[model samples]
Target chain A: MSRTFYCRGQTGQQLLLGAYGALCRQVGLGRVKMFPRTEMLDLVVAGGRARGIVTRNLVTGIVEAHTADAVVLAAGGYANVFFLSTNARGANATSIWRSYRRGAGFANPCFIQVHPTCIPRSGDFQAKLTLISEALRNDGRVWVPKRRGDTRSPDAVPENERDYFLERMYPGYGNLAPRDLASRAAKRVCDHGCGVGPGGRGVYLDLTAAVAGLGEKVLCERYGNLFEIYERISGENPLHTPMRIYPAPHYTMGGLWVDYGLQSTIPGLFVLGEANFSDHGANRLGASALMQGLADGYFIIPYTLGEYFGGAALGEVSPSDRPFVEAAKEVEDRLARILAVQGKRTVDSFHRKLGAILWEHCGIIRNAAGLGAAVEKIRLLRAEFWENVLVPGDAADLNQELEKAGRVADYLELGELMCRDALAREESCGCHFREEFQTACGEALRDDRRFGHVAVWEHAEQEREPVRHVEPLTFETIIPAERSYK
Target chain B: MKFTLFIWRQRNRGDRGRFVKYELNDADPGMSFLEMLDFLNQRLIERGEEPVAFEHDCREGICGCCGMVVNGFPHGPEKGTTVCQLYLRHFQEGAHIHIEPWRSRVFPVIKDLVVDRSVLDRMMRAGGFISVPTGSAPEANTVPVPKEAAEVAMDAAACIGCGACVAACPNGAAALFVSARLGHLGLLPQGQPERERRAKAMIRRMDREGFGACGNHRECEAVCPKRISIRFIARANRDFLKAFFVHPGKA
Candidate 1:
């Protein structure tokens, strides 16, 4: 018999949807069984080996445990912890918490990338909009008001009146400074009130001259979709007007600590794609995320798995095994406890409140004082979340509220860990910028003396501090130097 | 500005899709076509109706998740622009835009505006790789590929796999997608061992996926978001014909 595969809903759905379609065409759709919107509640641990997985099918309201030789978690990273992340709707930091609570090792959940350019938040209610890529910065110029407190639009300022800060600062790379630096620069200007857009939260990315000089055809060729996206969100035309762009938490460079083989500290469980922290050291280069994901799935994992299986001498373990049953029962009991709770606050309400606190305290810029306050705030919020949180639906159905509640519960824990990690790493390197660690020139200072290792956190008991495992990075090719575009 | 949108709506693979029209008034010139549609869907949801389903992830021009025929162009009239990159500012005040899913036998419509392009993935599986073993990161300058050659290969590697080439093609040929991978790997020394075999295997897989034969319409090159040249198609054809002679068994 063929081995059964365990995967989550959204991420798993996209992968299996493609994989099944390809496999079915090769060996008929009759041979494939796809399960979506299902929960992988527990991994059956049998004699230091992963035997099977227990899952609850949301569509059919059936709880089933499937036996498999190996389990792969392409679940994704903990981006939802940051209130301002640009991750998809379904993914939450809770998944990471559940995995850890069930004894999965995770790494660097705090090394999140605040994409240097995104459409700034329009209203308090707006969650997060789409990000325009860094590629636009190659051609489009970044500018702000020359005056320290000017809040005028691009049309009001003549060419000489505007200050193209990036160009003046770095002539070589200019506006295309690696994401971390660029994001900081935008924040600095916005905080000074020279920011454009509705809330003075963005700077102008002008392509009006580029459009006129290169012509619409050439401009469209370079950035058509980006132009469309800008128009859609901001109601502006790049062909005539400048686009208001700012940074938001986009991709997480930090994830479950995995080796070159994409295997985590846990033996049987494998993390691939964006879930595993590899390739990208501190900051990811342009157009590399897709490369890493496809490379991990299609090229890397298959060979690594073959080598692993060959060495392990693994045999089939049935789903009826004792450990599988126990794990499944544990999941069921947890769900029952959550469902039994009758509370007043809705899941969305708690999540929104959590997001607000996180964004205010932990987002963009962070210092020890802010992080300490955030930790206390998060602890208090988590307590209220457990006590007053209302989940309107049952686990058996497509309960959006239940899903959000579970994810928010995870976010509360993950947010605390993020602050702890941020607090511990005294140096500002790449995306992780602590206000206390920056230079007088507004550049991130790297303290290679004390903190140049990957921070891997081992999950401890509730209210107990997690153990930290340090993996010292040895760079053979690129020597550690102050990254200066100037 | 106000405009009329002609969108393609197909329920499933067997269902025949046609252009359905909707009107919008005082639209922002800054909004993308998809964003405009998103606004329309938000309205539809408020009225207790099913929103139009579309495939999009990472709205930045990278992920290759979103693709469709917009105003008879693969990524609209924009050159080197993907659908996700197209801004509404390029359009007139009262334009009538026609939109449709990629018309290809290999890529069938899954739902409204979403098409299955896993056939491209199948082609990649057939060969498009370096066959390097796992473990240890290679030194950056170890390969010593000339900057020119590396740049060309990188350019080819930039193909987003959006299938706009197929959407733009009259025959719905996936040559642009196939040739891009072929050229990307084939240009490198790491791809030397399986050079002939890779070309033969990938082309065969491309044919097996039910994509039409390349007829040199040059539409694929025209609409490519990265502006991958047609020279790659010729390179792929040359390699394919050469492989037919050298590796008959593999072909």
Candidate 2:
């Protein structure tokens, strides 16, 4: 079959709406049931197999147990745990977290890809960061002023005085360098005090050269929506000014460990998209997210799920089944416990504090000291969250706070696991960078012999540490080697 | 920087809501409109009060998750801005902002600022999509859409489904949103096969959803965050007319 990279930039939204449209059509066809304002609260495992799910209606806050022959978690990534990510506000780790707790192995929990081109953070109250698509790099030459605090307009920063860092370092790729390399490069420049914008936390993705070369009209034809979005957020016209971008949390390469059939270790439990840790080894390339999501949803799941449903030794599940009853009670008790605390700090406050620990200690650059410190800090914060996090709303109505409380509670647990995953790797590979293991010239040094295994963490008892399992990555036809653009 | 925000507070679809005035002070001018709400919510939660339940996700204006009328404007005074994209700086210091939900009969209030806009989703299912099932397509480039047509399709395609159009439209018509889907697919050869079916099915579904007829007030275009034009409405009307005259099966 022939292949091509074709989309109008908003491919995910288009394809999702299309799939959603089809799903809605199925509802019309009486072939599918619709659940719009509902959220998966927990997984219901019966007879040592995945049987059903516990769900909460976001509108009424009514917790109900729905038994499925097989449960598929299409719930998205945990990037929102960062508190200021490019993820949707409602995106959380609760579904996957519950599944992990129910014995689905959480693989490579530390593998988060911070996208390079995003509008820089403005203030503390900023809920989410916006992304300037990767296409901007095609026309935008990334650079920082040679002098610290230059305070000169991008055009005024004379060519020699301006350091086109990407070109100077990775000359072959330059502006088109991959996401991970570009993100770290941008971070390196900013840490040195030469970054642009309000807090000096941005690098210039200057389209001046592109506009000059291809003419502004052509650039506008290609990137008008993106340029307009940049201008809308920053109040700076990119036709005249440069778009300031920084790396922000975009995708998590780590998720539920799925086997060859896209089913988790637990039978009848299937995971897809960003929820499952499959394909895209350290970093994800652009636009494949849409393709993979569509392919899995439209193609793979139908065939695989059919095979499972057809041949599996499954029994009709009742709401009174041990796992169903226990899971539902656990959710109810947890919510009751959170309300019982009556703490003073808002969920957002604790989330922000937790985010700071992870970002500062376990972000792009990581070392033994930082990772160890993060693990301890997350544990303490998680305790404080249960004791002092204030959730004001009752669990009866459409209470956003109550909803957030549940998600944040899961994040506290998931965030700690992420730090542990980061610490255990002990070598830099893909987006997982260990400060102690890098080359003298500073690129990710892969210790393939020791760490070329998918670190799968299984849940232990409440107080005990989670056990880690290794799935060694054995390449059949390809050989892993040093990645260099020079 | 301070503002008196009179937010409509409803317990549920059953509750008759009223405006509760909140005085927010020391609000950073840089915070987005939703962030200011977050500030209020944090304060409320600390005070043992139920924080305002508003609809929002992807707070970056694209997801169609956020919907509210701010001070008589659908997304506040900012032109071509969703409520999520509206910054606090746009309002003068100490201004009184009236925040309300989309007050259409079809889009009943869920709690406070959130209303059920799933009607649009239902209407789309009726025929908004091309008949092309997933993996049933030839290679994407094989269709070979004309550049100008694709551009127009994208322009119409830019509707974020925020329902600001319905709130802004005096007739409560969803023509702009409905037409965008029609125009987007109709302009492409891939959409040609299902053109009449789409127009017939979607229009029937929109009417069933109880939206008023388009009086062509053009209010929807005025408040569109993507600045989607009403030209697509005319294109949709043409498709509807053609479908009425000649059913593909009858012809």
Best by DockQ: 2
Q: Which stretches of candidate 2 lie over 4 Å from their true place?
A: A1-8, B248-251
**lDDT tens digits, residue span B1-251, model 2:** 89999999998888999999999889988888898999998888888888888889988777887889998878878888888988877789999999999878989999889899988878877987776556778888877888899889988877889999999988899999999989988998888988977888888888878899899899999989888999999999888889966685432
For candidate 2, what is the lDDT?
0.86
lDDT (Cα, tens digit) per residue for candidate 1, span B48-102: 4445667665555656877888888877888876676676777998899998877
What fraction of the true interface does each of the listed models get right, in terms of native contacts kept? 0.06, 0.67
Please state how well chain A of candidate 1 matches the true chain A, as a TM-score: 0.90
* Candidates 1 onward: DockQ, in order: 0.07, 0.68
Q: TM-score for all predictions? A: 0.67, 0.96
Q: What is the DockQ of candidate 1?
A: 0.07
Looking at model 1, residue A208 earns an lDDT score of 81
TM-score of chain B of each: 0.94, 0.97
Model 2: how far is B54 from its true place, Å? 0.9
- Among the numbered candidates, top lDDT falls to 2
